[model samples]
Target: MIKNYRMVLEYDGSRYDGWQKQGNTEQTIQGKIEQVLERMTGQAVEVHGSGRTDAGVHALAQVANFHMDGKMASKEIQEYLNQYLPEDIRVITLEPAKERFHSRLNAQEKTYLYRIEMGERKQVFERKYIYGLYKSLNVEAMERASAYLTGEHDFKSFCSNRKMKKSTVRVLKEIEFEQQGSRLLIRYTGNGFLYNMVRIITGTLIEVGLGQRKAEDMKGILEAKDRNQAGFTAPPEGLFLEQVRYNV
Candidate 1:
């Protein structure tokens, strides 16, 4: 009998191309996992991720699922994966999942975290994960700008895909900011996000904080629906796929 398995993974994406497996290379998170599974099961396996994180982006809790013909115990599978996988990738948990459970399709919500360091001094250990800005930003202005972004709207201006044929509308449930000294943590929770949408929003908010744009300008940018109207796309290093939520 075939058994479906679910896993929660955490990976440092600095060296990975992304979550999706490509034909040309095996330097992706999905590719690495699939290769290991194929070796373990002695069969080709297709592993599906909750979403595709951009290159250089990290993940604290990325969900994935796959099917195997043999009945391997969850603990055994997890141990085998951890043993064979690279040091940067880890299988936090592995368990039997419902036959129809799909990590991407059944996702109800996803939260992404972006980290910014606003100071002259850069962190040595966290240099790989945080975005460092030389100057401090106006926190109040960023907050006002974030308020405009928290709602259902056409976020095409913030999307990087110009030839996107599908709908660009998305529901941004929340945008919260927490400041700790020179470090700023921005959290975004949404039903789904467009390609580079969160990074673009972060850029726009940074512009507002930098006095390049007013907080109220966000409304017009959203209405314009033109990608050029948005700010520059923030670098991928600061972004992390924090979590994925499901109804069950």
Candidate 2:
């Protein structure tokens, strides 16, 4: 009998092309996970993820599901999978899930984090994980700008140029910024995200922090609904899929 299971995964996606497979040219996180599963189970399994993160983005709590034969315990699968998987990718937790559970379709909310380093000295160890912005940022300005992004809005200005099937509207539950020493973290939780949404938002927020854009300008940007009205999209290396929530 085939059983469905969910796994929580964490990966440093700097080397991969993204979370989804694209033709034969690019290395993707999903493709890597499928390859590991195939090697362990001696069968091909399709893995579904909560969302497709962009290239160079990381994930701390990405959820995915796959079907496998027999009733093997989740712990056994987790242990063996970790042993064979590459160092950058790991299965943090595993559990049997409902047959109808689908990682992408069943997800209710997602939280993403964008990290940046301020000041002169850059941390050599975190160069791959965080974007280094040498200029000083106004945290209060960023907070005020972030407030404008909360609530339901058509975020077309923040979306990438790629085609999207769903509407650009998203409900932002929270948008916050915090500083810890040289690290600045921007956290966003929302019902859904469009392609490069978080990165674009971060870019716009950075503009506000630098005084290039005013906090109130975010409203006009939303109203314009034009991609050109927003700031440039930030680099993917600083972004991370922090968490995914599902209905229990």
Candidate 3:
């Protein structure tokens, strides 16, 4: 009988292209897992991810699902995947799922984290995971700017895809910030996000923190609905797919 399985994955995406498989490359998170599953089952296997992360982005609790013909214990399958997959990527958990369950279509919420190092010192081991800025950012100003971003809005200005036909509206539930000495962590929870939306919003907030832009300007930018009205897109190294939430 064909059985369906769900798995939570964690990957250091620095070395991979992204989460999705592309025709041009096999060095993607989804492609790697699919390859291992195909080898194990001796048939083609397709893995579906909750969402796609950009190049060099990381993930802590990405969810995925796949179907296979044979039966195998979840522990054995996890172990096999961990053994064959690269050290940077690992399956955190695996279990049986409903036949109709899908990682993407069933996802309700996603939280992304962006790490910023606000100091002149260079990162040693964490260089590939953090974005470094040589100056301090005003946390208070950033918080004020974030208020305007919360709630449902058409975030067309923040998206990178110029020709996107799908709706650009998304419900950004929250934007929380934490500061630990020189490290600043920003977490964004949303029902859905447009292409490069988080990065662009981060860049806009950084500008507000730097006094390059005012917090109140966010409303105007949102109304403009033009990508050029938004700030630059932040680097992908600092972004991570922190978590995905489902109703269960």
> Global lDDT of each model?
0.94, 0.91, 0.94
What's the C-alpha lDDT at position 144 in model 1?
Answer: 93
Query: What C-alpha lDDT, on a 0 to 100 scale, does residue 15 get in candidate 1?
Result: 94
TM-score for every candidate vs. truth? 0.98, 0.96, 0.98
**Over the full model, what C-alpha lDDT does candidate 3 score relative to the true structure?**
0.94
lDDT string for model 2 (1-248, tens) is: 99999999999999999999889744899998888888888889999999999889999999999999856778988988899888999999999889999999999999999999886866888888898888889989889988889999999889986466578899999987889987799999999999999999999999999999999999999999888999989999889999999985
- Predict model 2's lDDT versus the native: 0.91
In candidate 1 the C-alpha lDDT for residue 58 amounts to 97
Model 2: runs farther than 4 Å from truth?
A: none
Clashing pairs in 1: none
Q: Write the per-residue lDDT of candidate 3 for residues 166-197, one digit (tens) a residue.
A: 99999999999999889999999999888899
- Off-target runs (Cα >4 Å) in candidate 3 are none
